[model samples]
Target: MSKIKLLLAEDEPALGQIVKESLETRDFDVTLCADGQEALQTYTDHQPAIVVLDVMMPKMDGFTVAKEIRKVDDTIPIIFLTAKSQTSDVVEGFSIGGNDYVKKPFSIEELIARINNLLNRSLEQKNADTLKIGEYIFEFPKQVLRFRESEQNLTHREAHLLFHLYKNKNQVLDRSLILKKLWGDDDFFSGRSMDVFITKLRKKLKEDPAISIVNVRGYGYKLIC
Candidate 1:
């Protein structure tokens, strides 16, 4: 199989080079750009399978680039890289079609994992028929979660979290890994935010007796069925 194509749009020269080299080492074919305008051009020309963009960039912002990309193709996975910790920043990234977000000073290992996870999910949606978890039926195209007579339209974050947990059902998911991928940071504040989302998700899935989202003490969480 061909290497997965990636478009990386980061303005910081040193950091950009580091990310470019790191992704290349992991066997990804990456096209690097220094700003949103260049990034958008590269994305249009190459049609990469995935995108890694910095929210703060010159000549346009990551959000604008993501919007342009979405106009052409809504399926490509886009991950935002930013340093901001504000809740509004996170919400804005998601509102602009970002598949995931990573904060500044992140580890290469974390970025690699996010890329792999997002790509795997994209591939799965294209190849697999449906995901059946306990009594809930997940429909990827429609982004819907249905159980019995009730249904909820899942936001992108909710859908991705549920899918990840379902894929690893009955297995432990590291709290750090989840917080980083879902909220961009694993600090105390972000941890609390994640906890809130987890509670909401648990309540949403409460109708199904076979499903359980449990915290595994200080290590992580386990979604069992």
Candidate 2:
């Protein structure tokens, strides 16, 4: 059996070694980097199935690396590890493209679990890759939404947001549920970021007049097709 490939970026020497070894024992092919620049390069070179990044690294921070990665590929999951516990840090990580955030001094078990959860969701999404949203064809694994000959590449947040709304099509997808599930919080910043994603999705699907992502005022959103 081929092990899952994971990219881990941490600046602390001891912590990096321990994490790499721990994940390896669990049958992951881990490409460990000591800095954000190396992490970004490794991702570009090999494109791992999932990425684990430390926030404060030399050359580039975790959020910065995530931003770069999102430009080219939005399907890969990114998890951020940091000592910074400020809500702003967490919000920034999510707004920029992080799929999960873990604070420093975390147990390896917690990290492993989170990694597994993200990968499982990724696999499920791939299995149901093609969805017809009105006249648009949404390919989740490829992060492409197509209407006729026109194709739009969606960001990570946008793709996931759309997926959730599609899953609850014609029903009210609660605002709190989306904010918590996608951004990791229902805080003000996360809420605002979610609004941005929804607006973008609206535009992307606008080409198909039969589709509309309607705001439910204080309730949530509903995908009408």
Candidate 3:
């Protein structure tokens, strides 16, 4: 059996060493970094299966590091460690692609549990076959969207976004939710990218007169079918 690899970034030397040693003992291959810049570099070099980041660090913040990582890989699980536990802070972490969070002073046991839980959850989510939305048929596995007499091929992101829209058909799917779920970040560029995909989907589904994906102002979009 192979050990799971994780990149851990913490500015505090004592805490960083403790975490690295602890996880190593539990059969994890841990790469420790003292700052966000180093963390990002190590991440690219190591290609770890999971990432553990501390929110505050020298050079760059963990949130920034996570954003950089998200640009290349959206599905990798990210766990954040921070002393700040305000509601807004937690939301920001998740909005920026964090899979889980551990507050300062957290026990190693708790951290281990969160890490295992995310790893398990990652293995459990598998997309289903197809969906019937309005007058169109979506073959999810094949990334095909079909309307009468016409069919459109979809990219992986396109197919995934369409699945989310279909799941929330007739209801508003928050733009932040879309960005976070697909792009793994709700930053400006991610939002703009999502807008492009929305435009693409609109064009693809336009033939179905009964189906429309409308932008719900500042909140998000609604897929009405």
Candidate 4:
């Protein structure tokens, strides 16, 4: 089997080298970039399976790189490495299409664990068939929602949120559980962002009046069909 390819973007030369070497030890083909621009270029060229981005970079910030990457590929897993542990920063990362947020000074083991978890989840998604939701067909791997001949492309997070709701159709999923599952953390800002994505999902799934995502006040949501 081919080794999993990883793109590591960090301005700190020493840390980047250490991370690259460590990941390589675990059978990953690591491509290290010093700045956001180079990171973006490498990402395009290599099409790595996963990306580890440092929040603070020279040419462009990690958030900007994540946003740009999302434009090109919404499903690629992105893990942000940042010293900033602020809730706002975490929320921003998720809002801009990040799959995971790792605070700086983290252990290599933790990072490796996160990578494996995400990769496994992604693989599972790929093997799953399209799901039927009312009149729409939700394609998990493609992050698309199709109704009749019309189709709508969704962001990674949007598709993930919708899938979880659909999986628990007619049940009220706790808000905290949704936040923890999707964002990896249940914070105030993350909850607010979840609300925003719920709205977006509602809008996208609105073509079928029979399908409704009901907001269970003080709780989470339910996908009714």
Whole-model lDDT values for every prediction = 0.84, 0.90, 0.85, 0.89
User: Candidate 3 lDDT, tens digit per residue, 59-155?
Assistant: 9999999999987876678999999877667767876667777889899989989889878755443344668888888987567888887888887
**Order of all candidates by lDDT, from best down to worst?**
2, 4, 3, 1
Off by over 4 Å in 4: 153-156, 181-193, 203-210, 216-218
TM-score of each: 0.66, 0.87, 0.63, 0.86
Residues 154-209, candidate 1: write the lDDT tens digits: 76667767777877789998889877666656779878877887887898889998
Better of 1 and 3 by TM-score: 1
Query: Per-prediction RMSD in angstroms?
Result: 4.8, 2.3, 6.4, 2.5
Candidate 2, position 113, lDDT: 99
Best model per lDDT: 2
Scanning candidate 3 in windows of ten residues, the lowest lDDT window is: 121-130
Clash totals in order: 0, 0, 0, 0
Better of 2 and 4 by lDDT: 2
For model 2 the local lDDT of residue 160 reads 84
lDDT of 2 by residue, 1-225 (tens): 999999999999999999999999999999999998999999988779999999999999889999999888777889999999998788788878788999989999999999999999888888887999889999987778999999899876788888999989999999997897788899787788789889889888888788898999999999998
Pick the winner on lDDT between candidates 2 and 3.
2
Error of 2 at 189 (Å): 4.0
